[model samples]
Target chain A: MDDLTSDVMFEAFGKTLEEVFEASAEGMFSVICDIDKIKPEESLTIEVSAEDEKTLLYEFLSTLLTESEIKGLFLSRFRMKTERKNNQLIMRGNAFGEKMSPEKGGTVVKGVTYYGFKLEKTENGYRAQVAMDI
Target chain B: MKGKLKKLSEYKWLISKELMKDMRADAIIYANKKLLDEVEEAAVQQLTNVACLPGILEPVLGMPDMHWGYGLPMGAVGAFDKENGVISSGCTGYDINCGVHMLKTDLMEDEVKPKIRELVNCLFANVPCGVGAHSKLRLNSRQLDKVLVTGAGWAVENGFGVKEDLNRLEENGCLKGADPAKISSQAMERGAPQLGTLGAGNHFLEVQIVDQIFDTGAAKVFGITEPGQITVMVHCGSRGLGHQVATDYLKIHESAAKKFGIKLPDPQLVCAPATSKEGMDYLAAMKAAANYAFCNRQIIAHWIRESFSQVFGKKWEEMGMDTIYDVAHNICKLEEHTVRGKKQQVYVHRKGSTRAFPPGHPEVPPLYRDIGQPVLIAGSMGTASYILVGTEKAMSDTFGSSCHGAGRSMSRRASLKKFRGEKIKQELEKAGKALRSTHPKILAEEAPDAYKDIDMVIQSVHGAGISKKVARVIPLGVAKG
Candidate 1:
């Protein structure tokens, strides 16, 4: 459910860690623009490491927003892979979208906020909720 | 314990110290009965949460426009002893030092009305606006460092504004002890290209006409002499740079809180002791971000001058366009205040509030010292903004703080669902407002109907004797991101 104050909330389910991360990323992009209309004309790969899955998810989404601001790109599709090394959670991901033009770029997404931010395991799959500052 | 508020006066309400077992101080709110009814219960809960923060001075306060925020309520103010307090990034909000700067002009409505449309169009073309909008001037790493340390002074040195402009800015346009090294390279990257841009979501530049004057003496001191005189109001902040700094520090505080053994009622309120390395680093980085904002507004002010000159066929100075004052609404400032009859330095966090220092205060510029600080209150689109002066009553009652603006009364989602951008644009046009924006959807989301009545909100603060009304200005044209 969308929070009434200022931020938008996303909740999604997936079977794998990568799937959960990808769903969370998609949910975030939808807050900025209509997801179905985005055409993936280019590809970008992003890698981040954290102590745990929750931190990884936050960094991953925050990185996407930072990249969007710096490179002027609009990302719509997300592909992610996670691996553990030396007790560290490493996430490698590829995001696909086209350069931002007046038609493609939607509302300005400020950044990802930590309010009620989470990634969790469910009975059947995994569920995640991330709040975006818009 | 369930939240229960007791009326202390017509304009003040109190949440007693006994209301919550962990609360270190009572929570006091400034609001009239009508304004109080509009506040959500969740906002009161958050206010109580603030009361529970460590080393909090008694009477955590909320302005008349209080609303629920992630950790602290927007329009919330809290002071803590410098030696024992903790600092939370969430207290300052994501938009560090987000504020408004007002400019007064000698031109009158009759002189500007004919070219209002052209002036607005020129501004829309000159000012970069909207999401991820980039600035034309690119700064190297060294220049960025200078911006972090020098603030609006850097813009003045670059010939953007006169040196006198710095004097009218809050904190004289820069907070000291800002360490560029404290800012992350990634945050610098996000900020480098976004300087001088008006970011999306409620940020705007408006052309206004002074409609009425409440206090002639104060109005005269503020350079507002006649009704129908023209002015400009700019509302924005340090764009991606500030947001990035806040984002980074929130994560740091989350871990710092755990390390310090500070039990947080909410993850968003995670904080560290003020003297700790993490807290000190966050403060330094936050100051750097705040400096970026000061310089950002100064640069935008320069562009606004250019647009005016292009439209009026005269230099901005020749037409008398100069800054009145600039005030930060979302910020944490360390200042000296009297606590229990003893003067002490405290870190005062004002999120969605403005500093309202009274007359003779050393912080008030010498020019306006006798008249008190000018508190600029920006109204919603299609509404009348106000100018108020600070008072001693405010200094004692709310730690020299006042409401920032007419706080949001409706959700953005509900606004989008209920109104069409095009329809809102038409309504504004019909009301004699010239409008330009990067996206039409912003017009719908920021419709005046979506916010509390600014006139009533101002009345509450005025009635409480914290901030006195000086003049009212109605919008003539607006440009938004």
Candidate 2:
């Protein structure tokens, strides 16, 4: 594992959440919707600062899934602002979503889970991984 | 980033601020190295997330039976300042007052073993089990409100339990400030016909015998004379009523969290300030569900007594089938505790945890105040359960809480996939234990191996002085859902 800056890790997380949600929707709907149609609003920034990376990812995704369900929006863009502060990963991210329509996508992401969640800093970049709870 | 964990003692591990950001205090877990190693990292992450919650006092603690769960871990305990902290439904889980109630009988194992088959048969016939199982006693909307407000008292007044039973129950069997109006129509409908039924997944009623005495003085206080004395332990909760309350509030809390600017690590931990409308509604509804659960268990206990009376041609009173104590395992209560050396009213959430108030606490009933609150820990069938007492350490350390049971070692699906119900039943029968159940799949999910060793889990807590063991119970027969 190589040393990667927290900012880089945070960026990767934001991108990953956006990509995962879109890909999951595409997989569920069996059609790829135009991501460009969904616009990113001023980030309703939320942060999950925890000791370990695994739970950080679990909590982050779980929060996003919950927020999406409550707000009835489908996330289309994500941008992470992460920093290593005092030995903990402090993650700040903007998760963007468009109004989910049955005609556009067949289903919504139900939840996020802790199963198979991983966060590791490799020689090239930081990777925060998770298995979406459908 | 991983930081070195400092061993506070043999059973305590400290995760310092050097390991997490915005942590007001250290995160301490009470478990041996072996147990600690087995804990999911997700739980530890949740602990650190809890540290970020406003006005947290001291270390966020996890008991030995710790495992991953929504928001807070199953065996987690934390306290916060009343003025600043938030209240979370996830901290209490979907099942409100999902707890344990132990009944003592005059009959010994020698007396009941000969009639074990008949006894279990009667219990199986009387107690409803399995998912969506409804009872013969259905409640109208108006009567359901009474059940919510009065709790076990309603059951007793309706001849479900005796008056003496109230004295042994926490909150005297009825929680204050329970507004039935706060409960949703869906919740009421769900609970209307399920009053006396044992809902599925880890809920059970077991016929057990006192197998060992750890503290003779406490054992005597709790009325366990010696080994082989038969007892009954009932483990269930508010059924659909509580689940509906939780679901109703989870949405409210999510919106409340955004409005209040409360950021949580997990959506399950979504919450509102203690004084917010969302928080108040949740408390009211939660109390109502708690009452419903109390009444639910009271009814089941009554039928158990009735079943015994039918078989023995004697009244329950003549059989000495008295409730020793009933304690809620999952709940949040507004309690006054010393914070910064001043008494402050804070909501304490116990998820997969039991209230273990020390002796002489005003909240404890008068009769058992000197002996401390009886903490009942029910184990998987064919394993040892325990009766314990609250200690001063528990009051000071873990928000007057103790472990609920041998917490799940695996998921229900994993357990069912690994173990067969028929084989498990045969194994128990070979060991001279009788089993009766409505759902065979439930038996597989609740197989003994699905849970941690209750003996070891109880020993760790007892050894730590958080709670002291009184009596150990071995199952004679079990009724599972």
Q: Report, in order, each candidate's fnat.
A: 0.36, 0.00
Residue A42 Cα positional deviation in candidate 1, in Å, after optimal superposition: 3.1
DockQ per candidate, 2 decimals = 0.52, 0.03
- lDDT (C-alpha) at residue B76 in model 1: 88
The residue-by-residue lDDT of candidate 1 on B1-481, one tens digit each, is: 2237898888888999896788899989999988888898888888888788898997799998888776788888988789899888877878898999889999999999888889999988888887656687899999999999999999999988999899898888999999999999989998888888877777899999999999999998778899999999999998889988988898899899999998786677877888899989999999999999999999999999999999999999998888999999989889888888898988899988999999999999998999999999999888999999999998887889999998888877788888888898888888777898776777888888888889998998999999999999999999987
- Computed on alpha carbons, the lDDT of every model, listed in order, comes to 0.86, 0.75
DockQ of 1: 0.52
What does candidate 2's lDDT look like per residue over B1-481, in tens digits?
2136688888778888667667777778877777777677777887777777766677777888877666778788767667677788767767788888889988889888988878888988798775434487968888999999999999999988889999889998899899988887767776787789876567888999899988888787777788989899999998867876876677688889999998776766778888888888898989999999998898999999998888778998998898999999889888987755677886888887888899999988888889888989988777889999998888877778888888877765466579988898899989888998764555776788877778878877887788989999999999876
lDDT of 1 at B358: 99
Instruction: Name the best candidate (by TM-score).
Output: 1
List of clashing residue pairs for candidate 1 = none
Candidate 1 local Cα displacement, residue B163, angstroms: 1.1
Complex DockQ, candidate 2 = 0.03
For model 1, give the interface RMSD: 2.0
